[model samples]
Target: MSWMLILIYACVFALTCGFSYWALTGLMPSGMTQRLDSLKDTPHFVLTEPSARWQRWRDKLQRALSWLGPLSSATEPEDASHTFSSRLRFYNAGIHSHLAPLVYLASKTVLTFALPSIAIGVLWYSQVSLSQAPGMALVLVFAMLGYYLPNAILAHRVARYQQALFNAFPDALDLMRVCVQAGLGLDAAIDRVGHEMHLSCPELSNEFELTGLELRAGASRADALRHLSARIGLEDVEALVVMLIQADMLGTSVHESLQVHSESLRTKRRLLAEETAAKLPIKLLIPLVFCVFPALLTVLLGPAVISVHEILAPTAQGA
Candidate 1:
């Protein structure tokens, strides 16, 4: 039975890998393929002007690769950009961060098998009299759970990351405005804000750094910023980028425009805080009933209960 289970698991693993790779690779749009390919052509820097040994080695490696030319430049046919749902479909199917997806799926599969095996082992040790037929049914349930749990976890993580991005974006915009108004250019402002926020909140800072890199790589500032907003799927950042682009296009003073936007953003943040504060009573009520009230009642009633019990004890004894 153990050997049969192992064989079944092996077959299931193979099928999962084969089917996932086939479906995901087939669904990956050509544009993403081209974008990933272009990333290979990006020039790498290594502080060649004189630095540590690691830096020198990196420069040499980059130089060697540059001299060798691109491995293939045959110009693969490109597909049109996909809509958001289509993009998410590919991502969920395993286009982005391959290792994370594989690890998640593998762990889910292992846990599925592990849980039932553990339950069966416990039952055996407990001298339970469950028959083999019931045990097989439990094993099948475990296998199905293991197959689906990772996908559910991935969906949850994606949603959480999206929420964090939304919460962080407005602050990032306000910081950018402050830097711009304080006499820094866009690139300098982004670098400063990214550096400042690196320790406190990394997601928004990392996005800013990526935008700076794109600007350095010959992509226009607007394009890079728009891409940053799009990648995080945050509405505030998208609107901010649109405002910046319009300000630049219409020859408006960036500092003044950003100042106004920053004020508005701060107002929105304040309003959100107020709203959260207003909801505190509702949020606190559950804990008050479950935790606080019980303790309070015990404290207040303890002496009274003891006194009444003493009085009743004497009366009952006399009767």
Candidate 2:
């Protein structure tokens, strides 16, 4: 039974990998179509073949997962604020899929049941017997862990993305300041900065690119800037947005505002670095006490203790 279970798991894992590979390679539209489209002088309708079997399967799975969304919402209807916050989190983590929230909820639900089922299967296969209470408790514990796992992963992604944005903001501001001082309009400067920062600071570049896109799509500059700040979810970005809006409204010098904000951001970044450095010793204390100190003490006292033991052993035996 154990061998059979292991074989089943292996087959399932292999099948999943195969599906993933097929979806990535086979389902994606070929570059040939893009090249052909680029070469055409006049725009013409292009007829393409239907999606592959893998794509159909993926679409079906997505549809099935989406069903869980309504069920989840029916059970626990999120408030407008919560929905907005979830959207912000998803955006921050770079998930722009329309079905992201549905997929996330579905995953949580599936794991909540799947983990306990796996645990039970493992226990049954191992022939381990336990009291009913303890068995239920174990299942519940696994379910809880699995249920919260996605949240933990999302939180980590948000933290990492935010940190990247924070680190890149000062540089982006300096670039913007230079661009503004060089006679570029605010929108043009933003677009230029986005392009220039693509290699060095991709997260900020992406935000700026989206803002430029919104501006081009007919959004007001202030609205686009506010949306950018909201998507970034950073205090520095929010401050920059407010300053730019105020400067634009008051017809003040944007270049000067950018320069001043850039300097202040740099100072804040320096202070943050110093604060982290100051906390380094306290952070290191735990490892020093629990790990390094023990090893050092063992090394220093080990030889003397062995010598004493050897000398005492002979004397005690003789006596």
Candidate 3:
């Protein structure tokens, strides 16, 4: 029975890995792929063929998993605002797939059950009786953790993604400013700056590249920038978009306005850095008190305390 349970859990885990890999890869069509497809008379859209016998089994498992998709999404409200918020979260986290929300919700559903199942199997394999185990409570805890794990992961990704964009923005703005001053149109400057930013910050570069593509594809400047802001879900970028749109409308010196904004961004970045530096000691204080101080006190006084105890114990007993 233990072996059977272990086998079942192992299969569940293996299938999960395969499903995640399939879902994540090639979900977002690349620019190069799109360009190549445009050249083709008819480009087919289908799942990649399995390269091995095992993958065929995996494909079947994934198909079966798809049955749970409706179950997960059924709980989601059919409001546009909620859908937009969900889209914004995934896009800001750098996942551009149309299917990301579905994948995310479905994964949450699977994990809710899978984690508790795995835990139960492990306990069984360890020869712990269900009654001896925390049982249903432990199962519920694991289930809850699994349900929220993807959310935590998504938030982490969004934080890192935003940080990357924030850190890269000042330099990118400076480059764009230079390009504008050198007489390049805003669209050309954006595309060029995006190309140059690839090595330094691929994430921002990709976003800019998409914006540039939209511009070249005949999207209105205001609409393109708004879309960019929507995808980024960043206040600073949105402000920049508004500034540029206003500058365009007012016939103001775009180059000068951009330069000013770039300088402000640099200053803002520096101030943020200084503020973080100032907070470091406060951040370190907790660990210093909880971890370092106790260890230091123990080491420094341990011998003397032991000596005092040794001397006092025997004397008191003798007296």
Candidate 4:
């Protein structure tokens, strides 16, 4: 029995390790970490000597968890030592990051332990009278619900944040264009737009601010934009970054590029609006017939039905 338990523990451990590897490797696209390499130059507070030692410890743990593999050894040119620290800080922040996954992991662990323990205790208390364990069935259902409900909520929040970022991005680009055309450098334009957009789209604003800081701190503008695209994980942002990088490499006019991108983004927004408008009738049909149409019919025909019933009933009685 002891050997059986040992084997089971070893199997569980191996399975867990395999799962961790897969998760770390598979969560993001192929070039994600390369893109995040830009965070090295963003302005952040320096650690004291003691703090630095503590940070090194934290970073080791993060690297293990980050599953950076070969990428972990690669350093950013600008702020080589501080790069990992900044990324760790970003991960800890509440802005649509991976805390949800950690929460889910902890919750599942607790539920896995708690559900069976509770079920066994209740069953023992009842003296195990019922065969097939009705209590066990209830416990299983509740456990499934408890597990899935939080996941569903997290999925919704993540989706909403992604959509919000996607919707806010083109506007951010336009703002950047305005600032650039006003004679500001790209970094300055980014900072201005980021500050202005804080109230409306705090997430995008924060990311832009980070990008501007990276650019100012000696990271190339193209590198910073690439990092921004990775952080947001949106195709539009990626395309914009690519466009900006190409313009930089070719020594084309930044102002003209920004203008063209702004126009293209506006057209995209128009198409999205049309698509949503097209969906409205389909989305509204259920409520329109079941809710609105029934109410309208009651309002319009109720009195006439009552009048006909009254007139016909008396005439039939006379006959």
| Best-fitting candidate, scored by TM-score | 2
C-alpha RMSD of candidate 2? 8.3
Residue lDDT tens for model 2, 1-319: 4434644774798799989999898877665565455647644324356579967977897989977766546655579988898888899887777778888888888888898898788767666444556556667877997789889989999899998888888888888888888889999999999888865666777889899999999999999999998888888889989999999999999988888888998899899999999999999999999999999999999999999999999999999
Q: How many residue pairs clash in each candidate?
A: 0, 0, 0, 0
Worst 10 residues of 3 by lDDT: 41-50
- Better-scoring candidate (lDDT), 3 or 4: 3
TM-score quality measure for candidate 1: 0.56
Residue 182 of model 1, lDDT score: 83
Provide the RMSD of all predictions against the true structure, rounded to 1 decimal.
14.2, 8.3, 8.9, 14.4
TM-score of candidate 3 versus the correct structure, residues matched by position:
0.77
Estimate TM-scores for all models.
Answer: 0.56, 0.78, 0.77, 0.56
User: Residue 79 in candidate 3 has what lDDT?
Assistant: 92
Candidate 4 lDDT? 0.69
Q: Could you arrange the candidates by lDDT from highest to lowest?
A: 3, 2, 4, 1
The TM-score that candidate 4 achieves is 0.56
Which residue pairs come into collision in candidate 1?
none
Please give the lDDT score at residue 13 for candidate 4. 78
Candidate 4's residue-wise lDDT over 28-85, tens digit each?
5654354345436644333335578777976665554454322322432437466544
Ten-residue segment with the worst summed lDDT in candidate 2?
Answer: 39-48
Q: Write the per-residue lDDT of candidate 3 for residues 1-319, one digit (tens) a residue.
A: 4544645776798799989988887597866576466647644322365479877766675677678778877878879999889888999999996657767888999998999997787776667666743555666778998899999999999999999898898899989989988999998999998888866777888899999989999999999989988888778898899999999899898888878888888888899999999999999999999999999999999999999999899999999
Q: Model 2 scores what on Cα lDDT?
A: 0.83
